[model samples]
Target: MGALLILAPFVPWGEFLSASIKNPGKYQRQKVVIDNKPEYKAAAGKVVNVNDLQTFPPNSNWVISYPSSGDSTLDAADADTFTKYELIRLPAELGGDMKDASAFVAFNKVCVHLWCSPNYNPAEGHKQYECPCHGSAYRLPDGLATAGPAAIQPPPTNAMPILILTADNDGALNIEPPVWEVNRNGVLGMGRALYQDGKVNVYKEAG
Candidate 1:
């Protein structure tokens, strides 16, 4: 018998965005993007400049790299993490479900296939992120699998892991720790276990 196909019903952008915002664990405030070798640093209360991403233009993306040396389970060489996020400004008339013209969305840098980092490919006005390892393509704005083996059979999850983000008036964005890992049927799995109320914990960004 063929494998069962699971599909998640249409999920509004607002609903997914809101759940992440309301339940995200604590985040350390810092300037996510900066200049120099490290290119990022920890700060008490720093606001990120969203305008810095404008250089990539709408439909394009900026790759954010950060260090992650504290984890002992990870390989010794795996000392950094990456996330690709895009900012798009579409006219209301052409907008699908994205309510805001300036929409921001992000996903794990690791490709579900071989864990290779996917690169943004804005071709013919369509925004997509394609994996270099096996030519798998994930649709932008939602991170759904669109092509290649990653979208077909033999893959665990077609959709990419989404990072929930919330921004402040100053344009600084904070990431919620709990990641929503989408499955083949569009269902979600917890990237990490969550803590209950009254048990204090610090959610640190891997990058």
Candidate 2:
């Protein structure tokens, strides 16, 4: 079989501050075996050999390199730690409220502003999207700034993947036929990418 890869663990891009890691840190790419399958975690910058691995209970919904194997026993270039934050995707159907498919534009699941991980919280009968740090909130119906420090509205095509599904008689949700995989990371990883990669259309002057 060929290699099936799970890319880096993404955090919301901007939740953590820029000055967090000033000095260039060491990155060690580590190979992790999942269910007897070999996988890899690339380090932030360069290669390192960590003799030990460390784990911390995850406060956020996504999982990161936790209590992994090869703790201080082995090292690789994958271990160079970088603060990579990305958004999480959740699927929901049109729910009969919309009349056309064009009602939404499925973005690559990457938030343009700061790449802070996006989360879904149903509030006031509308989806309330949130970033955990600094209290940035957006209206789910439209990625408009409801109340937060965001300079401008995040485009509707960024925070979500177009979803179509139907509920079975037993209440199990089923995606009809084809399913697509996306790397919202395609455009840029986060604010870091935006700044480094020169994607300027993202943050327009909020009038």
Candidate 3:
């Protein structure tokens, strides 16, 4: 038999090798796209402003970059330990108002492929996410990678987790961690949700 075709995300390294080597034509391959939907209240999560993403709210589930360094051009490996952070909520305005459109940004803290951590490079046009290991690129605006070696095509499920956000009474915004991963069936794998008490919930984003 010939080699089997493998897709991405669900086509984990192990599965691809097995199918391609032993069981050719046993499994069909597909692609999964990262969902960069704006994290909002109910429908979809609102997007985080690029600037506001630098800071953290008073009280929320958002993970803040440790020892943040404002250097945008910083690479993933050189981003300093503090440059990477997870967010639960963000302020409507960086220091002014949410209407500025430059207040927040949304991105996956995880890699599109094996869920690895990505590196940031401002020199590459304010790059928010990139996998140094496989060259998978991700846009911070919505955690969507325009190009890279993720899967020849996008994953069937939300390759990149969606960061849904909401503002609290104190005008502070909060977001849940990612709770879904791609499965063998090319469908969204429900994981522990940030909003509820389930094993995996798609309502929240990941860390």
Candidate 4:
């Protein structure tokens, strides 16, 4: 029938929607153990020191993995792709500071459109997280989708899940343990709504 053909396009979203409704807690934010030995070249795992320019330079990004299991060593290598996040240090001109959390931002690399991984393109004037699978692009610093199919999607899926960062006394960056709540820290793949002036406005689905 014509209705069935029209609804075929939305079939893919049903799985995500059903999972979100039936098991909302699965998408809730939760504390994760950062791997002491992250992949990609950083062996010390302390390579995120904000004060150390040599460790984490401005406009640079790193792919880090966090263990989903409470045990750090047990799940370090087998950590899920959703647990992996891209940490980016903004340039000084973009509010990056030596000892400020605002200077850095981290987001889950899983693309909300189809769960494909996205990579940060640091090219000048093209500093955006772009997904090769579907051409979805998320803007830096905020992780909001600006292009491709993801931009037309609704909230939560339209944005990438962000990780809250903090700077220690030594200027080493740390991830604030996330709680199981939306908009507070950030949901796993669903993401949270963006707001201005540190104010968060929660989004609710209509019945």
Return the lDDT, model 1, position 20.
Answer: 36
Rank by lDDT (best first): 4, 1, 3, 2
Give the residue spans of candidate 4 off by over 4 A: 1-44, 68-76, 196-207
Model 4 lDDT, full chain set:
0.63
Q: Candidate 1, residue 29: CA error in Å?
A: 6.2
Model 1 regions lying over 4 Å from their true place: 1-31, 34-56, 66-102, 153-156, 180-207
Can you write out model 1's per-residue Cα lDDT over 36-134, one digit (the tens) per residue?
222222311123344434432345444432222223123223423332322222222334223222355555666654456677776665467787867
Query: What lDDT score belongs to each candidate, Candidate 1 first?
Result: 0.43, 0.29, 0.36, 0.63
Alpha-carbon runs more than 4 Å astray in model 2: 1-110, 122-127, 141-145, 149-162, 176-207
| Candidate 4 weakest lDDT stretch, 10 residues | 2-11
Q: 167, model 1: CA deviation in Å?
A: 1.2
Query: Model 4, 107-156: lDDT tens per residue?
Result: 88777766778888888887888989768889867888899777777665
User: Model 3 over residues 1-207: C-alpha lDDT tens digits?
Assistant: 112211343434344224323543332221111112233222122223323433322112222332223222232234332123344222332222352322334344555455556555544344345567666665544444556555334333234444344444443444332222332211221111122243333332223
Task: Name the TM-score of candidate 2.
Answer: 0.28
Error of 3 at 87 (Å): 4.7
TM-score of each: 0.51, 0.28, 0.41, 0.70
